[model samples]
Target: MSDATRPDPDPSIAELEAQEQRLTLTRFTHDDAWTLGSLLVELARQRQAPVAIDIRRGGQQLFHAALPGSTPDNDAWIDRKRRVVERYGNSSYLVGARYRAKDTTFEASSRLDLDRYAAHGGSFPITVEGAGVIGTVTVSGLPQLEDHMMVVEALERFRDS
Candidate 1:
């Protein structure tokens, strides 16, 4: 199938919710975005994985990188996934999984433009306690589930540090 037509590989909404719950941070900063983006790029490089990464705060792009072998399309995916984060205050993976739980797509439920708002894995809200969601961290170029898991794991490491 074409990239646009391909199915998203993601976990159940419950599982994704578990991830979101654990990934929350006490604070999210521009420096944190740098660290998270660097860690994700290093991980993908070590695995020889092509991935695109973005960390944005308050409508500003803080960090962005398209790794070797990534295409322009991945950039678009990152934007779309991040849009989901901005709109829902949740991870894009969780958003998509929520749709699946209802046996529908975001477009079907929300009637949003499919190209502008993709409810797929990768993008996560950069939320701070009492501050609410301030930004998003996003990755693309893997199966949706893998993309989501990578971000979650990175956030876990960040939280523990």
Candidate 2:
């Protein structure tokens, strides 16, 4: 079939809704945020690291904590995490995947913008499998690798519990 004669691929309504659902990070509750924050603080202590952490539900702040000596610069990670996840509908890992796929512009620029992406930090989508995004956990105050690791650890703990 000629390219022009082929029908364009389009999703059914249910498929479209499912896709939208997966991408939607719904607002979290104050309680949920606080819980996640406490988990992060505890995780940081276990790692023996002084880090600043922020947890958000949708666009709202649910929890925030700065370890001793954490600076203002550390606090911005959460915002960056939110911005990246909000735009990409995926976690930092997914963003990294996109980078690997040669779609590096958004990921690269997002990492550079402190207001929306931490160079080494990660954004974890607080979502259930097939449910879409519900919130995010963003942690900073260490190398980007460490920051991402910490967030991953915290999410595992939260998810398992």
Candidate 3:
């Protein structure tokens, strides 16, 4: 694709931070988790995207699903990505982008066990108006960006609804 036809670059770290600020929820209940999780599942099915979706509040898992063609490996990825969100209180994609923006990798700089914590995309912090980051919503089985976008899109729709 020509430069003009090329997709825009991923948002900058500042832009991603702004997105986190903007996406905060007024409230998040168990029912909201169910609505959001079901929305994600519906969207993925519409796209025929094989993926695993997970929603958690602190140590409590609120919702989870493994779509057609998804595998146990996607569950592993969900855990790793969710760990990143829990640790940083930021979206996993934003954390990874921050490292990349500094011309480094999370694995190289974090000194954390790669098997336990993945700073890859797909996991987003679920921040409430005043509760801070109460949980995480994550997806796996797609490319990092696509996985992240899927969660983002689902959240936006949920928020609007």
Candidate 4:
């Protein structure tokens, strides 16, 4: 097939929605924050990654950290990505991807301040079975895709363990 006819590897909206459904937890607690946050930090450390990580429930933060080399910019990105997850009830990466697929921009339709909220990556909603999304976990520093992947990988490991 010609390059023009080749299918894009990027996921569709349906696929992104499925990811949100699959990553949801039946229950979440402060204990989970300890476990996941520790694991996330360790993972970044092992990779020698300079990143900012955050886990929050409602309006309160349960865990937050910034590795060596992480700067205030990283912190700002974390806040932006976290808000993206909260606003979209999905991964920040997925929300951005959805807009990319539609050939639209998040800032155009969202009407929220682009400076305060980012549609980049590395944020996921903390969804409980009956309670819905109560908070968000976000990582920032690496490339958007890598940031998103690391968060997802950590969550997957934590859930399966």
Candidate 5:
């Protein structure tokens, strides 16, 4: 039988194609970084939560800040954020995917405690045209959704810049 006449085993073939096509990250510039950091602080203040923000480039710290009374958990958040940023080059999306994957690493109900190292906030991979993942910016200390929102907004702002 022709391939068209054969029944497809994979139900999500169409969806998978769409996802792969959409998994793109755009480049940003140096001025974009300043705007991102500024918006991050603004969003945290608007939410009435203390925040810890870290920006890294070339595997080195570019900028770091902590609002008053930021919790100790920020340390772990930073590490996990860095990992996700490195893994997917987009912190919020990859972290969400990790949570949803069937054989997922972030499964908490299972014997393995992926929750310990699991992160659910916002981190983003900073990239350039000819280079990739030159840096990352991670933020924590608000509600998970808000944290992701903050990063998305910053990236959007950077996108326009």
Candidate 6:
């Protein structure tokens, strides 16, 4: 079937929520952040994706990288997307999807300053066992969906390894 005829590849809210639940880490430390961040950098390098990645915990940025083609704007996007994850304690993609499913955009429904917050994809909460969301992993410089998927892929790899 043509791509247009295929079902949307994006996961449903339940699926994304399950991801958040299932991907919980036993513990996350500075070293863990380094590993995850390095993994993301490697993935992006392999893909030749021009993206900016950021990982933060306890309100402190642990790692950040801007790939060759990425621009400063990507940093802004990272911050905005991270804010969504921070405020909602869910992946930014999930938050945006929930709003879209409700027949409204997050920009219209959230009533928050658009400059500081974005409901677009690319940020995932770093949830640990026995702790809620400890931080966020975010990417920018790709389409929102791609950005979100990249983070999810890295998180899965990090968890599995």
Overall lDDT per candidate, in order of appearance:
0.87, 0.63, 0.94, 0.87, 0.62, 0.93
Tens-digit per-residue lDDT, 7-116, candidate 4? 76565778767767877887889999989999999999999999999999999999999999899999899999888888778889898887787889787777889999
lDDT of 4 at 81: 89
User: Where does candidate 2 have its weakest 10-residue lDDT segment?
Assistant: 11-20
31-95: candidate 5 lDDT, tens digit per residue: 65666787777777777668888777766676777887687788578767677667655554455
After superposing candidate 1 on the true structure, give the runs of residues whose Cα lies further than 4 Å from its correct spot.
Answer: 1-10
Candidate 6 residue spans exceeding 4 A from truth: 1-7
> Backbone clashes in each candidate structure, one number apiece?
0, 2, 0, 0, 0, 0
TM-score of 6: 0.95
Alpha carbon lDDT at 75, candidate 2: 71
TM-score of each: 0.90, 0.68, 0.96, 0.89, 0.67, 0.95
lDDT of 1 by residue, 1-161 (tens): 89898865546667777877777789877888899889999888998889999999997999998999999999999999999999899998888878877888787897888889999889998878888889999989998988988888888888898
Ranking 2 against 6 by lDDT, winner: 6
Best by TM-score: 3
Candidate 2 versus truth, CA RMSD in Å, comes to 10.7
Local lDDT at 104 for model 6: 98
lDDT for position 49 in model 4: 95
- Comparing 2 and 5 on lDDT, the stronger one: 2
User: Model 5 reaches what TM-score against the true structure?
Assistant: 0.67
Q: By the TM-score metric, which is better: model 1 or model 4?
A: 1
User: What tens-digit string does per-residue lDDT give for candidate 2 at 24-63?
Assistant: 3333467767876898898788777778887776667778
Clashing pairs in 2: 80-116, 120-144
Comparison by lDDT, 1 against 3, better one: 3
**True lDDT of residue 30, candidate 3:** 98
